[model samples]
Target: MRPFSLRVFVPSGDPTGVLIATRDDGIGKATIFSRSLLGEVKGRKEWNLPGIYLLVGPSKLYIGEGDPVGKRLEDHAAKKAFWERALYFTAETRLNKAHIQHLESKLVKLAQEAGVVPLDNGNTPQAPALGEEEYAFVENVLADLLLMLPLLGYPQFEASEVAAASSDEEVDAPHAAATGKRRAAYSAMPRGLLFHSTSKDARATIETVDGGVLLKAGSIVASEPAPSFDVWMPKYAQMRRQLIESGVIDAQDGRLVVKQDQFFSSASGAATVVRGVSSNADGWIGADGQNLGDLLRQWKQKNFC
Candidate 1:
């Protein structure tokens, strides 16, 4: 990606209430404020303008728009307890109600389709009609927002790693099959390594990806976490419970089978969740049957040099 300039300001020396602005002329600005800072955020001049905003917490998300944004945020702060932080988007020139409404509807649809975060929005808002220029402007704003949100520690707007991987597979499959050379090039490329659990009873394969590790679809997880599971791997244990509750894993033939492709942020995370024990990065192996550490070193040497 090409380099772009971003200016960030902390009004009260608190990192939680940050103002982010891009140097790009048409891209606009975003204010990231913690829910605790609602009173301070409300005092900002931006709140009086028409804008779209995102309310995000650890696991839940809500998207909204307001003609005068401060009132909406004030209402949410009073009634909504799940959100810890909010991100508000506004233009250089104040947006009209119709423009903000259209942007809100599109962002809500995007969040719902991504399915990475649980949406707290009870109902989907209808998008207002827009002229060609207005629609194009909103689209550009959306693209910029997606890039900026991740930088501000919110990745819920981005597509899930599994979805991105699946898209890559679809695009590469036919070309690799037709050219044969494509397959050779891929085999030679320093891509994410794959591995299998060393546990005798666990029939699972895992692969590391750009942002996370994948517990491939159809892999097996323990029906219940190990007795020492929480003591050794508290996060994975919690994730396992969440997976079960989310219906991503189901008991089938006396074992837990993954219902779909699942992504974890690290190899050890995926391994612990699948094997129910603490795992080391060295435990995994790559396509050439080398240990993960060695494979990674080799990849870095070849690519970075």
Candidate 2:
């Protein structure tokens, strides 16, 4: 990966209200400000240029573009109640109304596919026409914006696990080596963990991976959460519900089965959602035939000692 530099300024002593600029020439700049700081930043010169912007809230996202970007933000502040912060992207010279419209169209599509946050935009604009050079330039700008957005606490544009897994790029040698070790260890193990739903005929295989756990496709989950499901954190419950609602998992043969591979932040999180009960990460067995806790201890000794 190519290294890039970012310069961020906090104007109001509040880190949430920021101005982000890149070292790369021709790439655009971004300003991320809270709705409360609109009065302080609305008159800035960048807002007068044609740009694409995002309105982000706790659970929802909206993407748009306009010339004289200040006016568009003002209108959204008056009408859109969910968003608490806005991020605007504008170029010094290359960007124009057509370029911004194209960016808006592409961003909306990406956010929807990411499914990291729900979109509030009712309509998606069609991408505008541009020459090959201009299109490539805009793509570079968008790439920078995507990298910066997540660091700024706006993750709506982050790629989904499936998308990341299906990327065409070859894995780095070190990562490929580690993955090979994991697969070999798993193959030699007697068995993986099996989590069973308390309220239904559902079960799933649990496997450890780098940084987290994987719930393999075709693994089963309860069709509905059990009455005692409150044993798990609300966020885990919500995640399970979202998976069902999104049709990522569906009921068949009296149980819900995952349609695609899924990742969780921890073994316990994956287990809790699969079993609809409280779970302990240490209880999960690893490929070495040791529990997760013991495996982690061995790994730490080898890598960190």
Candidate 3:
């Protein structure tokens, strides 16, 4: 890939002004995001809203967006995966921390070299004006950068995976490769016993033992109280069904075995709640609310989006 390009908009208020980089990209893929009034400018007629596109060949691809000559090329290595795999390339700045500083620095230099002036007053600026030559230069850099992302393992799944598979006979749905599993690792569960309580402490604490969730509020209470686990609710229908299919519990058995309840709630929870399973971790709903929070945070940290 070539260097990434940077684009800035000068804010309306100032001129001796400030230049705020709105979007930066390696070709079609950009990290900095921005919107333009030109899209709504009255009677401009020929100006079109910017969009990304790819021109594909037997063994190569050409990717780009907007006028290439006008943009400033910066770092392209950081944006490879998004252009190739993501349906749209928009990520929280934190998600690209490793490369943000480097790219940001390069943009400042490029903007100044191009005689682009900052809006001033320390506020964000509007996009700088680009001559026909400059705009085309930036466009080329962006397109080249976009072309490089595919080489970095950004699009691992082939076109066949992207296309919907046709079938005469119904089969299991294809899942994302993140889990590397054929079908959902867990099945739906049936409604069963429930226990609810609230903790008064500042920090939330939870533990799972004997197939039951243990919630601890703080030192506020002398001992952790156990809630009733006998009542079944409709929400658990899917969980119950999964347990029955897994052979972990026999529905007709009048006796409520603790082992059966444990199996149904954990290993055999509903597939809807089981985000996925891996070789070591069995993904399922957490027994305690805190556990659920932890699971969600982990998903976010991994940048599942």
Q: Can you write out model 3's per-residue Cα lDDT over 93-201, one digit (the tens) per residue?
A: 2212222222222233333323323311132223244444443444344334334434432231122222121120111223454222212121111224232222321
* Candidate 2 structure quality by residue, lDDT tens digits, 1-305: 36766677665676656565554542777888888888888768887888889998988989999897888999999999999888898886878888888788778877876678889999867878776567656666776677777776788766554311101111121366555543443344344454322334556766555445578888888664543242214456667877877888887776799988787645556766776655544545544556654554455456545
- The candidate, 1 or 3, that scores higher on TM-score is 1
Q: Candidate 1's error at 50, in angstroms?
A: 0.7
Question: Candidate 1 overall Cα lDDT vs. reference?
Answer: 0.68
Task: List the candidates ranked by lDDT, beginning with the highest.
Answer: 1, 2, 3
Error of 2 at 25 (Å): 5.6
In candidate 3, residue 282 scores what lDDT?
A: 24
What's the count of clashing pairs in each model shown? Answer: 0, 0, 42
Scored by CA lDDT, what does every candidate get? Answer: 0.68, 0.67, 0.27
Q: Model 2, poorest ten-residue lDDT window?
A: 163-172
Indicate which candidate wins on TM-score. Answer: 2
* Candidate 1 structure quality by residue, lDDT tens digits, 161-216: 33111111212234534334323333454445667765645667776664446788
Q: Distance from true position, residue 267, model 3, in Å? A: 10
Best by lDDT: 1
TM-score of 2: 0.53
Better of 1 and 2 by lDDT: 1
For candidate 1, what is the TM-score? 0.52
Position 151, candidate 2: lDDT? 74
